[model samples]
Target chain A: MSQTDVRMDGSAETRADREATPGSAGGRRERLVTHRERADSYYGRPVLNEPTWKDHDIAAYLFLGGLAGASSTLAAAAELTGRPGLARASKVGALGALGGSLYCLIHDLGRPERFLNMLRVFKVTSPMSVGTWILTGYGPQAGAAAATDMTGLFPGLGRAATVGAGLAGTALATYTAALISDTAVPVWHEAYREMPFLFAGSAAASAGGLGMLAAPLAEAAPARRAALLGTAVECVAASRMERRLGPVGEPLRRSRLLRLGEALSLAGALAGVTVARRSRVAAMAAGAALLAGSACTRFGIFHAGMESANDPKYTVQPQRRRLAKKRAERELA
Target chain B: MKRNVGKVVEYLPFLGIVAVICTTSWLAGRSSLAGRPSLVRTPVRR
Candidate 1:
């Protein structure tokens, strides 16, 4: 009848403990226990706010920027190698993709002047500011190269612009990875190491695909090789990123779009190596697949980052693990 | 009919710019000699 109970081991127990224990004399009062198997936040709210970027706009911007940058580089290489057809096609593709990328970026910002405002200052620490300046410097050169190629005027100026754009393009292709990874999103932040390589490889593959689609077969051998090499690099970087991310990478692992993109990329590379050389239609189809695959990959990554940010557990668990690791290390020391 | 004609005329400049860009892109795609030919015929010596 007493609330306090004594054990044979000389320990005291309470009525509440008796009720909580199974098969106890207190008749085991029915108590509700809500056990949590994993980390969570108050009221099940996310630990981090989801990124406000629109998937259609930002993902397209990412994909088109990469395409434009890599195409300019390929155009420069084609020019140096005397593949005039490939050079013209790549230059045109670079300018077109750059225009689309700028449009998407401006559309996302909701004002054209907001883009110009980004140019008022240069910050080495900010990826967005650096990216704005890079785009500004790269855009005019790309436009000039494409314009001269289109009209057959200012050949000397075109050559200079082509080389300048090519130099800037390498940075443009990979900087978006830093922009996304610098955020607190669990998946994106964790992938900083491999993301740049993945973006660069995807850019190269898409550029090569464009060249193969538009240029003559006789001049497309380099494009085919580039497609194959880029596919290999992208696949390796993606796998390494997922593997290193562990639990934080669940969103990427579970993405059907990412898997489909990988499959399409592999199939495109296979087709490019085999039937693409023999038939123009096959080459075009393969190119289309590669371009679609790259676009899908960018969208998939954007969505996965959003998903990781929306879930409280992804943010909480990683911090908890790191704290535990530091505590253990301190104890050892 | 008059209203439709006025709208078309209003957009003529935009339409013309798009047409020019498209035509230039098509020409660039078709012409192999669109860009300047490579100045170096062979690999440069170190």
Candidate 2:
């Protein structure tokens, strides 16, 4: 007896031959077509390390930091213009958000003590270190402003703090883009030019949302303007980012959930800006939508980067293509 | 003049706080770098 009698079909067909067949065991032809031109990997695994940060904690931190930064700026504007209500609302909002952002950052660090290790060095190459210093400068100022507004003490001190916080807030809002884009992640790195603007717009919208929710309609007019301006900026930056990213932007395009969030955010912002003047409910709804949209934007960007990082083709093909193009250009020259 | 003086007095603590923060950050940076020697590169000789 020969040992070749183990076939269930009572034939001598090999596994590869069976798999390559058109209508064999599991419809193999379609699988072959699906992966026809895809780049190879180590057993189809990612070449780079996936981010170890938790999705909710880090994404929420990004959202809260933006909110705090924008609100601080709004507070400064309101204070300078003598809109006490808006100033108070924005200051309180900024302080609360900064507190939450700090909590989220520490929570994400897993060990709270390790958060101090980040403060041990100030390296220009590390965005996180610079961000920590910015936060250190901004946090106390924001807290003092809010405290003075609450306590009705040291008006001059509060004014100075607001001025300081406003300056730091701008850096805070824009530096987050640096934080994520400085990484080797293809999607984030590629969108470095646009991410800051996108983030700033979202932050402004978030601040506007806070203002409208906290301030009276008359006092919240600035909030409405900020929301509209922020949303417009966000939409423009997002469009440019998608267009310029080439194939690296595929993850962002293919992400239906992120797309849905952005659509909702934009529609909500447009509606809020257009109709909030007449209806307080509309204003409040717009605020809620803007906040949700900002959250979605952050999560979407984070997820897109993760998706790009998970695929080896995204990591390798872009570099290879760029190198080849450069070589060709050099030869022509 | 009195109000100006009072305002200046009030700001003393804030200024002091900022100074302390800067000093602390400077010290932290200094201490970290103190242990690590600078890696200056020398020109390659033929």
Candidate 3:
């Protein structure tokens, strides 16, 4: 993967080969293209050791993860309690997340039009490339399924759509972890087990926020519960990540961004639970906090991944040590 | 597919944006943007 070889102007590179970029940003013959291209060229630069994904990229992931997480939570809660209102909320939430995820996924791409090109060569090796395809596949299927909230409003085909969407939505809720877990980033990859559960919680809280903002206090009780549970999950996930990610996770442990994210998450979690018992307004406030907190978490994680990528120590050392150990064992045998 | 659908869906929300851009470019072209005298354009001999 060199970036310099690819010509952005001559229609999205139809060839399968990876493009080559110069070692330094300015070293290459700067071929200027569209306004967006010029802006994006500058956009990928790093000031920090690890530059987080773009704001839109982070925000889009946050929205989708939250929506997917929250909708599933609502679905689970609604199933238990037999509440159509809650169920309706879940479907709508899932659909919204689906649409937003699609937007984010597409918007985050250098070539939104050629997003499908991601499927050109599916490498189970590359988490980013794989995640792109997963996103492409899951987003629409799940979103369509979630549209059961509206699709069921139609006639004969509505029921079938509902069942199909339910199956898709179910898969969408938890698969978020697959996106991060399969990455080269050590912190995220290592935290794979917890990420799914953690995202599930954040998603629930996000749904709670929307529910609190929209639904009447009585109808939104499950959402409140979902928020509380999600908050707990997020807190636990954060703590576990802190403990597990070790030195490689220093960016997350030290950054001010992580601190803000922690504060917001804590505030949101506490507020959501307390307000659920107290007033509707309090619940709304908590929900907002949880939502913001989740956004921060996504941003923080994105930053950490970039950080992990930049420093060769973080990227190379573990693999080298593992390879050496394997070689020694083979020689001994 | 988003490619085909985006063609139709893409234009809906962005028409105003494209219009603004086109309008601005049209206006700029009509004016003397490239022609505007600058440090580079100033007489090197003088």
Candidate 4:
């Protein structure tokens, strides 16, 4: 693999200069650091500056994750209403999305089972690790819920199984934000508070999409409410992200794709909110917007993260701040 | 409806098997690539 071209803020001192590297913060040269060595060399050079996934690949991830989460949420809702068919459809759909998402996440890792390595040592500091645990919990819970249909022959224990499954399904609904927040990317990290709401909106949008494709109008009726709630949630998520992201959020609001997606989403969400109670067609339009908006969010967030990683300022500045604080402490002592 | 539900459950294991196969093939590909040696160049000579 090739080494990343990461440099510090001082272009004059950094580019093709020994003392410009952050590792040489003291203006003293150290041994040359390899890319692999730099991976764990905190406060040093970065090795991986970008994700390998294409735009479509990233959209697929957002789609599958949202679909899974939404379906799971809908499943819990259906169960509460005593609608077995809706509940069944939700479970089946959620499993499909979950299975697809699991594949994409592993595929995107470029090291596949390296995911297992993540599981070996779960760290609170690692968002990915926490996400892994969430998925692990959700998977079996969903499976058990699906299993309950068959186990209903054992009526005595079936109630317990159903209750347990409902709890798991709820967790499956919205932990994705936790994954995004766990990243070192400023745009996503700063928007952590808004991630759950953003993800919630996207999840509702996904359910709306699937309903458009599969469920009959009467069956999909609740999707209208979901769409409205999701639209409102997405609006809040976007506003919250903007309020919190400051400079980093500029990419989301300013980038052509992001802006277009957001506009369409707003239009779609507004239509869903205003006319969904009136017409099925409007709900469909809103759902489409949700899907588009959700996809845009993933694309925007991923690119922004990559941009944040690429610019020397994002990586170096944070480390420099830490180093400066330490030096000040030592000098004072 | 009951019969159809049974039939769906019956096919689930098959779906799980397919998912397992896909995940395995993907992981195998990943391991082979990560293990392979890709070339890297040295820094400019001072």
Error of 4 at B35 (Å): 54
- Candidate 1 regions exceeding 4 Å error are A1-42, B1-27, B33-46
lDDT of 4 by residue, A191-279 (tens): 78887787778677656544432333334556556766776777678777876666556656666666665676667666655675456
Docking class of 1: incorrect
Candidate 2 residue runs with Cα over 4 Å from true position: A1-43, B1-46
Q: Each candidate: how many clashes?
A: 0, 0, 12, 0
- Give per-residue CA lDDT, model 2, range A70-184, as digits (tens): 9899989988986677777778778877877787788788887887888889999899999999998899999998889777799999999998898899998889999999999
Candidate 2 local lDDT, residue A140:
98
- TM per candidate comes to 0.81, 0.76, 0.63, 0.62
Q: Can you rank all candidates by lDDT, best first?
A: 1, 2, 4, 3
Worst 10 residues of 3 chain A by lDDT: A39-48
- For model 4, give the interface RMSD: 16.5
TM-score of chain B of each: 0.55, 0.72, 0.42, 0.67
Candidate 3's DockQ is 0.01
